[model samples]
Target: MLPSTYLPSVNRLAPPSDPSLEERYGSLHIRLLYHFEHDFYHHTKSLHPGLKDMLALFMNVGFATPYLMDELLAYSAAHKSILGQQTSQLYLSEATRLQTRALTLYNSASPQISKDTCLPMFLFSSLLSQHVIYNVSSNVHNGLGPILDGLTNSTIIHRGLVAIAKASWPMFSEQVQQQLIRSCQRDYMPIPSSADSRGECEVLLSRLNATDMKPESIAVLRSAVENLQDRFDAICTDSSHAMWAAVQDWLVAIPAGYLELLNQRRPEALVVLSHFAVLLYRVAEQWFVGDLGIRLIRLINSHLGPAWEDWLEWPNRATMEQL
Candidate 1:
């Protein structure tokens, strides 16, 4: 891993001291960025947390520095090979930070911040696109295989689906949108070796399709779903509770309007809606167990239906009894 204290080289933006200096440093930087992003994409779970922080810092610099932006664009245009490399670096280095920054920048009132921040925001969107396509095309079996296995229980399956749907919908780039729809069109193979796991995967996929369709932007919805599907599948297959939680949080963050749309058009939004409903049911169930559960049940029942009541009776009810 690169030293946490490492700063961009002193000569980072210096005019080529020599003709080759520009070519050499530029090439090296681009290549380094590529490997860094590749590692993040393929080995994020295994990566050191400190390294992840460092990468996030670099990504901050990329977005925060005007000089770096100019250089990145110029380098990308001059050396097409370097484009993906630079993008990967910016993405893998501090992806979550960049994402947070993009949202902040988007919400900021300053024109300068908004204009300058769009590049990084766009870059982040691009990274999402790449992940969506890769997961849809190559990792489906390992990713979705296990999640489908556990879907036999309507509640689990429903929550899983909602999680997937929520992950896949909302504001995103056009490229990602198209890729998601294309991925869904592909044949789905069951995990013959793990019946329980495969059932979960199917439920998750179904739910993903549900919420994904709620976004007014069909293009954005498609791409987001593709990416969500991959992540959702991985969660079930790996039994990654933390990852699953992250997905659930993202789903919960969606606007109420979108969720309402899904509810209204449940047939078209079955995949995402069922998944979201199930997730809500689980959270409500959790609330019911702690001293807070009664209040939560009342709060949910005020707006939702008997689904919550049914969930309270599930055999897995004890799983959420503690809160």
Candidate 2:
């Protein structure tokens, strides 16, 4: 298992002359970086055309930090692995090794969140999250145990960013913050809130409301569901590729106690998550998410047994609509 992802800022500044990717990381990474820029990056854009702006902002954070470059190269290799390229195992091994190297480079430094470092750090963490989710989602044949473990790892990665962001929000460049943050908050503007208007979420919310859990736990689950409602209402309707942000929020901004329940695979939390998986069903062909939506809902249905079919009914039908 990989170490908990850490988005550390270097205590020391980069050298007087910023080194280029080929110059610093050498030829093997140079080719991967080439594939990422010329091929993989644009392919993602084509897949999620509406997300062009958000992705442009994401990719603008550069190889200034070697770990960020390492992440890019690793994800590039992972792309080849996912596609079942020649020597797919070699690509997978490279992807795994490079990501580990990225984490080590991050941890080796003191984490000082200067303005200069904020966006790069955010992108670093985000790329890390994508690769984790993509890697796990791609390999779902490994079974639910590892998928759950990967889900835990992905959550830990995003939560680490949330912690870092909370501590360093002021240091982040105000100019570019809205470009990303507003995409995340698009639902915040004058949207309908009553559960009746949120038809997709009506059952999920009602179930949370009827539950016998503690008020704190109840509040946490409700918060996750409600935020999920925001995402479903706004992003899912457009079939936006910005689902990356939804996945990120699902991991990071989820109500604190909700994650504990999810970690325990509480019926309530998993049911809410199953609903979200229906949303994921839209992008199933996207390599990053793979067929996770179908797989996750099926796994949850089986895991929860027959008694909970009432709760899973809508999610199951929704995915069938995709079929």
For this target, which candidate reaches the highest lDDT against the unseen true structure? 2
State how far residue 273 of model 1 sits from its true place (Å): 5.4
Tens-digit lDDT track of model 2 for 1-323:
11223432222111122233244466777778677766676666655433556555655665467777677788888887766567788888778777766665677654466677766777777677678888678667876666776776667667877766665677766766666665444322344556535577778789878879999888888888887777665553444455655666666667767767877878888898888787677666567787898998888888899999999988998887544
Cα displacement (angstroms), candidate 2, residue 149, comes to 2.7
Tens digits of per-residue lDDT for model 1, 27-49? 54555456554544344433232
Residue pairs with clashing backbones, model 2? none
Off by over 4 Å in 1: 1-119, 122-260, 263-302, 305-308, 311-319
Q: In model 1, where is the ten-residue run with the lowest total lDDT?
A: 1-10
lDDT of 2 at 101: 68
